[model samples]
Target: MVTADRRQGRRRADPPPRRRRLPESPPPPPRSARTWTWTWGTLLVVAALAVLLLGRTDVLPLVAQRGAAVVLTTLYGVALAVRTGGRPVISGALCLVLGVAGVALAEPILLSGLVVLTGVVSAVLGVMLTLPAATFPGVVREVLVAVVVAAAGALAIEGYAAEVSRERLAYVVLALSLAGALLLVFRLGAGLHGLGRRGSVILAAGLGAVTVTLAYTEALRRWASPGLLGAFESFVAQVDATLGGVPQPLAILLGFPALAWGVSMRARRRQGWWVCAFGVAATGPLAVALASVGLVTAGFSLLYSLLAGLVVGYGVIRLDQFLTGPRGRRARQLEAASAHRPEPRRTAPVL
Candidate 1:
């Protein structure tokens, strides 16, 4: 039956249908991504601190320390390769095998000798595996130059070692080898040309300082008084205390930010910059650890710090890219879509 109003061409008003209620979803289960990130980050930091503390305690057996060193070196090499866009898993396995072999071969020699041998071998392998294919010829030539220089330097060091007190020979050899390697890299590789005149001068000054400090320390060790040595030790202790008793090896972490920033500035290209950054990060810690242990002289610490600064600088740039890159754009798109979506409307019931 139709209403009289409808017969007269006037429609009856109908009540609006009740709005349907949506079931409330459980609050997004506590963002596991953030949780996992923080958990892993905390664990890694703790592990690093523990390792540094243990190393400084001088309680670990020498063999254990050497093994730890080999493992760390191999890991660093793999990380450097991966960060530079090379094959990571294969590089990691190769690094592990080569590092172990080098360490095993060096075992007949003293710990210091083993350190030098393993370091050199690891460095060579890292360069070979990580460098771009196009640079192979240049790298090969550089390798030849490096080998000749290293051989000559080794002979000189042997002569120097024979003449010096046994205590001083290791330190002297290590310092000279490091300086020589740096010089060869700068002279033969493209690094120096890229650095410009001012950078070159700075590098030269740093090298000079390292050499002078090594010589001065060797001389002092031969003639300095017990009182003077004690005073120096006390000063070092004070500095350590001021730094909250952080082991010197771990001090490298503090300089990461600065290193990444500097590297980004020097290497404008993304791929090149990342490679440079990882290289610096990996090597800088090794340098710092060596210097802290007196295996490398104090002057060389400046160079190591600079390397770390470069690594961290590049890291900063990478972080910026992540925040503004493709992923970031996608996230913005999702936000826009959600914001513009229309709400559901209620419909009137028909009579």
Candidate 2:
């Protein structure tokens, strides 16, 4: 081996280090998938719009109009599933067949005890679809989107104006929504395997709240003495008159807080999925806001409930931050060091 001379122009400068290239992000969904989504989405919107206009003009017969509404709502649910990274063509076709059968057998199913079952299942789906967010504002935005989607679903099912007593249509739409949301969340939550101890507790609590509330309400209606029932009704009426509308207690107490905290937790842990499941208390009621009450009454109730729930949600967030967040004089530094990982966009597939 030849040795270099120490005096040779200060030992020629070392070659510059090769520049390191950061890994590139994964490519977006295929072009064909995007094209299919856009095309299918546009078609659905146009068809739904046409149905709405014709129904308003009374050009479509009542039975046909209701049937069309159910189909459109089912299609909307299929679109929601596609948004969750499903194979659009396959899932859409399968759901369409089920939707047709639903329309044909709606009356028979309605006469059964589908209302309660549909309500609970749809509520669970509503909460799951809300997903998780990285920030408070992000959570709020997601909640708003959930509300808008629920409202659209409600509108799709309200095709029979004269048959005001037919609440079964709403349950059908709820069933469709439940089916779509479940298809994705089942995978996202990693099914039962992912629900560890904490997740199990949260889920149990959520189900308990919903079940107990429903049982209590039904019991009050069916078994309470007339005097007690009248007193309760009077109290509710008085509260409604005084406050313009009474907010749903479930929403204010459980749904909003659980959602806010759950999303915040999801930024840190998967257990957030369990907590988010409780958010259905709010979303489920909001889904049928128009169906359960008059337009004006629904509007007022929703406004009050939303405002109050946000306040409670904010409190829950603060409490969570206080309990689990960084502390001490170096808190800001700790937070900076523990910056959150980036999340996918709202419309993007999270799993």
Candidate 3:
């Protein structure tokens, strides 16, 4: 009876309904997806091998060969995307459209478009094939994958008869590769907030070094006095003659070390991806190295780069150990077990 007066004043509010409990994390991918991914990768590799071997022969028409190459390269990119956290169906559909367009634009008249597509494909393959590793040996394994992918991309780009300047092609490929890699790394590292003070400084310094090198080279080429330009070219020629070719500065100085240290860091933290993004400096130039320099010089150059880069990577690993790893050998071993958590399998989606 008294409740009637209470209702007139203000009825008691009902408690909000309990919301459904959400998952702590997304479920792992189905077994079928992983199996299909491996199947597709194997088939694509075989197809690519066949094309590379038979590409010069009359067994397949030139147009058909190039078309197959473009499609295969694009499909590999889609597979990489899926393995690196992309939706399989969507990436597949989008890559399919791009592949068709690439095949259609295979004519000499449309060479520029093909060059652009080649750059896109190479960048995608270069960046997506990489993952943060736990040790220097793992980083070396990743580098090998990058080398193979780049070589395949180089072959595909070289299939066309028309030639764009090597400098222009290299620049395009590097720029696109850097952009895509940075974007992916941003997501992988959990955005700007994830980059603590040390990470920010390291990333900034690395970027500055890369930018200055690129800018200085371009300026010397385009704006330096004729005498200076000639002198530079002469020096480069002498170096090439003496050493086959010097290791790429970008790869030796920054890319490989960053990859090594970043992966080591990833064993403890996510911010390592920010550093690893610079690895494209090595892989980007690699994609166009063969196309620009010819087989023998490119081979020697890559060999030198690998050796120098490994040396740098080793130094980086030791420095990281000094800074952050445990005090003694035994402690370090125990710390490694505690800090270096297991990651997803190489062929699985990391995210």
Candidate 4:
């Protein structure tokens, strides 16, 4: 008859369902993030060194630095807006007026703090807006890392500047060392893309301009007659007061990196134009920071800006050549072939 098994109407209970283990996604390779971190970190370190050199020599005054910070933050916002295809020139102008008014009305310490806070917020917004929508999260993480690194670098520079306040030679040595480091970093970047002879020349010229400008400014400060220096100082002070202490020199200094980046991008045409544009735009903040810290003066800034403009213009011309040169020929051929392609005949539509 029906055995116990038959009575149960079932064989052994189905085995418990196996839990399928998913292969843990390999921790995302951090190459891209690390590269961005290093790039931004190096840039900040270089900026800190510049500030220290300028501040120790009284080139970057507190009032100038404050004004510069506000200006830079505004420029960064404008740059971000431009990159995102939004026209914020009017907004930027309005922000600048408001910043100047705020500076005029607020206490020095309070204004400085407010500017710093605004800079932080602007930096975050700029990064967020500049990144692609598809990869926003990864970009945000990288930007945060960069900000932390840059902040740490700035703090270290400030401490070092204080420590070496009395040591003129120490400042000189430190400036030279930082300059060398920057050169090495840029040389490496150039090397990565195999800069051609023309590229090398452009790079050398840019580096030389930076070096010469720094040396000239330092020399003018150190060796000029006390009468001359005093006259210059008075003039600078007047300018600062007239402009509400917004230093133009730092703005020019900020333009150098942009000019250099544009040259490099032109040297390697495969890179995006937007990247070069962004790099140039990003300098507005650095320029402000330098001004805030007393790393640049009005006269030198104007001179540097002129030189940087020349260099960037040259780079743009070179890039245009590529578009109109042999490469353009190949592109034209492709377009011609596509234009000549025949359309397939379709049967008349049935009524």
Model 3, runs deviating above 4 Å = 1-29, 53-61, 105-110
Q: Quantify all predictions' global Cα lDDT against the true fold.
A: 0.40, 0.61, 0.72, 0.41
- Please give the TM-score that candidate 2 achieves against the real structure: 0.71
Q: Which 10-residue window in model 4 sums to the lowest lDDT?
A: 342-351
lDDT string for model 1 (221-264, tens) is 67899999899889867865564332322224422332233233
The per-residue C-alpha lDDT of model 2 at residue 26 equals: 98
**Worst-scoring 10-residue span by lDDT in model 2:** 111-120
TM agreement with the true structure for every prediction: 0.38, 0.71, 0.82, 0.37
In candidate 4, what are the lDDT values of residues 160-263, reduced to their tens digit?
22222223422343243234323333433444365555555655564565457657777998899999999998997786666534433422443333333333
Clashing pairs in 4: 60-294, 65-291, 65-292, 249-301
Candidate 2 regions exceeding 4 Å error are 1-29, 32-43, 46-68, 83-87, 98-131, 160-186, 190-197, 328-339
lDDT against true structure, model 3: 0.72
Ten contiguous residues minimizing lDDT sum, candidate 3: 107-116
Candidate achieving the largest TM-score: 3
Candidate 2: how many backbone clashes? 0
